[model samples]
Target chain A: MLALDIKHLNKKYEHFQLKDVSFQLEKGYIMGFIGANGAGKTTTIKSILNLIHKDSGEIYILGKEMLEHELELKQEIGSAFGDINFYTRNKIKTLTNVIKKFYRNWNDDAYYNYLKRFNLNENKKIAELSTGMKVKYSLAIALSHGAKLLILDEPTSGLDPVARDNLLDIFQELVEDGEISILFSTHITTDLEKCADYITFIDNGQIINSSEKEEFIDTYRLVNGKEEQMDSIKDQLIAYKKNSFGFTGLIHTKDFDPSWDIKSALPNLEEIMIYFSKKENLHV
Target chain B: MYNLLMKELKLGVNPFFYIMPFLTGALMLIPSWLYFLVLLYFCFLTIPNMFAGYKTQNDLIFTSMLPVTKKDIVKAKVSVIVILELMHILIAMIYGMISVRLYPNLIYLFFKPSFGFWGLCFVMIAIFNLIFISMYYKTAYKYGAATVVSITATILFAGCAEWLGIQNSFVSNLFKGAGTEHLTTHLFILIAGIMIFAIFTIIAYRIAIKRFEKVEI
Candidate 1:
């Protein structure tokens, strides 16, 4: 079963629009939503959560139509953004008490367990917690509600490397039983490279690609060659950068011709993003 | 819906606001003061501060992320406002009764703290809610313009009503003169004011829901 399905999702602001955005995340897996800032990642996430009304589209979560069953569907989906700072003066316990009342399946045992695992003290005010702890607190609340799918937007943006790795481990553990699915949005491609089973890349308000992580990486090549060899594949390159030794460029694996004799290797997620961003700037 | 209301009361409101009514309600004890200012304190202080807290705390985004609808979100907020408004008015009414008992022989200069006058206070708050709730939901985050406009409307309503009581003999008779002595007339005006309060608040709730639905966050 698909945990989430967004079809033709479109939301327009004065200067930006999510154009025909579509993707699906299978249940029991983690899908990385990748895009740079203002590339419609948050906008798409908000649309799926119904925080912003889509101009036109359909969103389905856990096989239920999102708009028609928003409240019910929301019960099965937990979402967190790394930047969310809520009620700074309120203690964690106070906020949790308020949150627990809204969910029908809220599990005290699970809630307490997560608190213990995260090392979150109930008495600490939101203002007292560091950014990583805040993210953990949000995850605790989300997981306690028996959510089947978690949608996280930039959940690792402000964390240290150790904290980021710890969160990635927790994410991997959550989906091990095939009962939970995650759709995590972040520009931190390294985190996705660590745990993401699937990848969906968006650039300039449109979906560039969505597929399994290995296939996604396999689709692009990072080609390096001497300056003399650049002209043969210049038109086929997505974008290229000049280095001290030679020139390096990004190309679709299918576009690479072996006869051209350009040294090429599979591109990493960061390389893909950098090339895509360069491609955008080149047009502008 | 009930849980959402509880969330508002528990997390959204400051504990200081819960106690503010009693402190401000004591103002009614002063003899022949512009009693309108007693309830006006709520309009001036509570609404603005509570909304500012919501804005600063990012309450709207947090609430929207919960398993609730936008309509329920607006409904819960409106319920909180009504609850606080009622607390202010009811507490002040108690102090007003005590003041009237303490100064029984004193001739009142403005509208006395009578049932009819209490009814007018309800209408004033109703006007405040109508303006504040409807306007605030247009953005669902910014409350300064809404608070200013609504408080100004409430003050104008109070000032105009009080001015009419002093200048118009018939208006004065209805609230202060013979009307105060007659339980039926005071009851009628009180009921009328309560009805208006109910109607206007519901209208405001409806308008707020409409405006808030269109809000992005």
Candidate 2:
């Protein structure tokens, strides 16, 4: 079953609008929600979690309608936002005691295990933790409640490379049991590249692409060529950048010119995101 | 619901708020026209400070992440406010009794801190609650306007009541003079005040619930 199904979700503000954005995360896999700043990634996540009211949409979690069954569905879904928005002056022990009471499936053993693994002291106040530790603490809480789905928004935004790699490993392990799924949102595409099985790219409050990670990556190529060759393929390139020496850009594999002496290679997730983001803005 | 209430006790409210009742209740020890000070102390010190703590802690955003509905949140918060208000009144009532006993011959220019005055305190708080809670819940984060409006209402009620009691002879006699000898009359006034407090607060709570339900965190 799909763990999250958001269909035709729309939210409008004075200057921005999320227009009919839709995506689904299948169980037992991680779906990377890729976008730039203000690209509607957080907006979409908030809409699904009902932290903000939507203009019109249907959000289903674990095959149940979200609005009709929020309380029930919320029990099985865990969410971590970019910042640790908990009571910063309170002790972790006190905060946990308060939060655990809301979940029927809260497991003390699991919580203690996470505390040990994350090196989080229960006696320490939330404000005392560093940014990376704060994110770890949030993940610990999300994992402790026996949550079947995890929706993380920019979870790795400020982590060190080692910490980011450690978090990616944890996400992979969580999905190995085939009972948990994650919709991880981040602008840092490398983290997703390391662990995501599927990818959904959102730009300007709309879904630009959603597909298996391998298929999506395979569809694009990074091409490097001399500056004089720019006009030959200017219309065909997804996005391009040129210095005085040379130019490099992304292009669809099908749009390649075989005789141009342009070097082509598989584009990484970051390249794909940059290309798509630039493409979307070019259209505007 | 119990969890939501506990959440408030743990994070939203501060230890100072719990101790504020006893401190403010002590104001009733003065044997003069300071009866209104007891109610004003609570309205001024406790409510605004508690709300400030809530804002500093980002309580609304944190609570929204929990597994409770908006209605549950409003209920829990309103219940906490009522509990605090009751604590202030009950403790001050005890002190009010002691002050009266300690100075039996003291002349009360304003209404004495009697059962009737406690009822008036209830009405004063009810007015504060109706304005403060209803206004605060509209946005949930903007407390300045709510506090100002509610404090203004409380001050007006206390001031008007005190002025009328002193200037209007019939009002003074009914509340503080010979009318004190009639148990049934005072009892009826006290009951009426209590009922008004209950009705006003209940209406405020319902309005708060409706407004808070539409508030997007």
Candidate 3:
């Protein structure tokens, strides 16, 4: 069964609109939601969590409608944003005591275990923790409640490389049991390369692609050719950058012709995103 | 709902606020000063600071993250305000009784600390809550304008009531002169005030919930 299924979700603001956003995440896997800043990634995640009201949509988590059963469904869904710093003066122990009471499935043992595992001190004030520790604390709270689905927005935005890698490792280990599913959104594509099982790309409030990690990357190819050779496949290229010697561009693998006598190679997640961003600037 | 209330009392409110009622209630012992300002201290100090704390600490977002409905959130916050208001009034009432006993024969310029006076205090706070809660939830994050407007409305209520007590002979007689001797009248006003408090607070809660539901967290 799908852990999350969003169908035709739409939310409009005075300045921007999310149009026909749809995606699915199967159980026991991590789907990385990738997009540039202000590309509607946060808006989509907020819509799914019901933090913002959607104009129209159907969101199902674990076979239950989100709006109809929000409280019940929230009991099973865990969410953490990278930027939230809560009640700085309150000790973690105090905060946890208040939060744990809301969940019927709260496990104290699991909570204490995560505290030890994450090296979080119960007596420390929230302000004392580093950014990385704060995210870990959020994760600890989320996991202690036996949540079946986790939705994270920009979870790795402001961490050092080592810290980011540590979080990525923790994320992979959490899904090993095949019972918990995660939908993590981040602009940092390199982090996703380490652990994301599926990649969902969004741009300009629209879904560019959503598929398995390898297949999604393989769908696009980066090609390099001389200025003269560019004319042959220029129209087919998604976007290209020209250097003094030649031009490098991105193209759909399906549209790439073998007889074009150009050098083409598989693109990384970052390369795909960069080219997609440049597509807006590409003039006819 | 109980858990949500606990969250507000424990995390949202400071310990100093819990002790503030006792400190401020001491004002009622001043031997017939303006007793309305005694409870007015709550409107002046506790509420503005408490809500400012919620805004700075981002309590709404934190509470929203929990497994509760939008309605429950409004209910819990309103309940906390009521709880605090009751604590201030009850503690001050004890002081009020003591002041009245200490000077039974003392003539008063303002309303004495009687059951009827306590009833007026309740109505004042009710108007404050009705204005504050309804306006604050429109944004659910910004409390400054709401705080200013509501406090002004409450002070206006208190000012008008005191004016009536002084200018109108029947009002002065009821509260300060022969009216103080009427137990049935005091009881009736007290009961009416309590009912108004409940009804107005429920209306505020309903209005707050509707506005908060439309707010995007």
Candidate 4:
């Protein structure tokens, strides 16, 4: 079953427009949503959750229309935004009590267990927690409510390397049961490389690519050669950067050739994103 | 709906603000302008500060993440505003009773804290409610323009009512002088004020729901 399905989702602001964006996430797998800043990653997530109204689109969560079954779907879907938008002055315990009442499946034991695992004190005020700790707190609340799907935006941006690894491990453990899925959105591509089963790349409010992570990585190759050969291959490159010693560019694997006499390697997710994001002026 | 209401009472209601009623209610002990200040407390201080708390805490964005509907959010917030207004008036009414007993024949510059005046206060708050809730919910975080506009209307109501009470002999005789001798007349006015309050607040709630439904977090 698909956990989330969004089709032709469009939203317009005075300065920015999300045009004809669409994607779907299969159940029991993590889909990494990759984009540069202002790439409509958050906009797409908000539309799926119905936090923002879409200008025109159909959104389905758990096989039901989102707007028609918002309360029902939201009860089963857990989400953590980039900002700690909850009451900052209140204690975590108070927030828990207030939030837990809305979900019938809320488990106290699970909540306390998560707090212990995260080394968080329920008595501590939300204001006192560091940004990484706040994300952990949000994750704890989300997990304790028997949520079948998690939507996270920039969840690892504030964490240290060890903490980010720990979070990825937790995500891995949750999906191991084949009952949970996650749509993880972030600019941190290395983290996605470790746990993402699928990847969707959005650029300038439009999706540029969406596929299995391995398939996506296989589609492109990183090519580096002597600087003098830059102009000959520039037309075929998605994006490229040059230095005094050499020039590097991203090319489709089908376009690569040994006859070019250039070194080639499988590009990482970060390289892919950076190359895709590079403007035409940067190619020189 | 009840859970949303409880969340407002639990998270949105500040302890200091909770106690502000008793502090402001004590102002009724003043000799002449007891009623106006008590009413002004709700307009000038309570509503603005409470909304500021919501803004600082980012309540609207956080609550939108919950399982409740936008209708429930509007219902919960309007209910809170009414509840706080009632609490303030009820507390001040107690102080009003004591002030009347403390000085049996004290001259009232504004309307006395009688049943009729309480009815006027209710209508006053209702006007504040209709304007404030309607305007504030349009954007959901903007309370400044709403508060200013509503308070201006409130001041106009209070000012007109007081001017009529002090300057017009028939009005003075009706509300504060011989008017107290007839129970049914004031009772009818009180009932009319309450009806207006109920109608205006309900209208405000409906308007608020419509405006808030369109707000995008």
Which candidate wins on DockQ? Answer: 1
Q: Write the per-residue lDDT of candidate 1 for residues A77-168, one digit (tens) a residue.
A: 88998887989899999999999999999999999999999999999999999888998999899899999999999999999999999999
TM-score of candidate 1 relative to the true fold: 0.97
RMSDs, each prediction? 1.3, 1.8, 1.5, 1.7
For lDDT, candidate 2 versus 3, the one ahead is: 3
DockQ scores of all models, one per candidate = 0.86, 0.73, 0.80, 0.84
Candidate 1 chain A weakest ten by summed lDDT = A226-235
The C-alpha TM-scores of every prediction are: 0.97, 0.95, 0.97, 0.96
| DockQ-based class of model 1 | high
In candidate 2, what are the lDDT values of residues B1-217, reduced to their tens digit? 9989988877788888888888888888887766878878877888888888788888887788778888999999999999888898889989888988998887888888777777888889899999999999999988889999999989999999989998999878876777666777777777888888888888999999999988888
DockQ, prediction 3: 0.80
DockQ of 4: 0.84
Per-candidate TM-score, chain A: 0.98, 0.93, 0.98, 0.94
- Point to the candidate with the largest lDDT: 1
Worst 10 residues of 3 chain B by lDDT: B56-65
Clashes of each: 0, 0, 0, 0
For candidate 4 chain B, the 10 contiguous residues with the lowest summed lDDT are: B174-183
Off by over 4 Å in 1: none
Q: Judged by DockQ relative to the true structure, which candidate is superior, 3 or 4?
A: 4
Q: Give candidate 1's error at residue B130 in angstroms.
A: 1.0
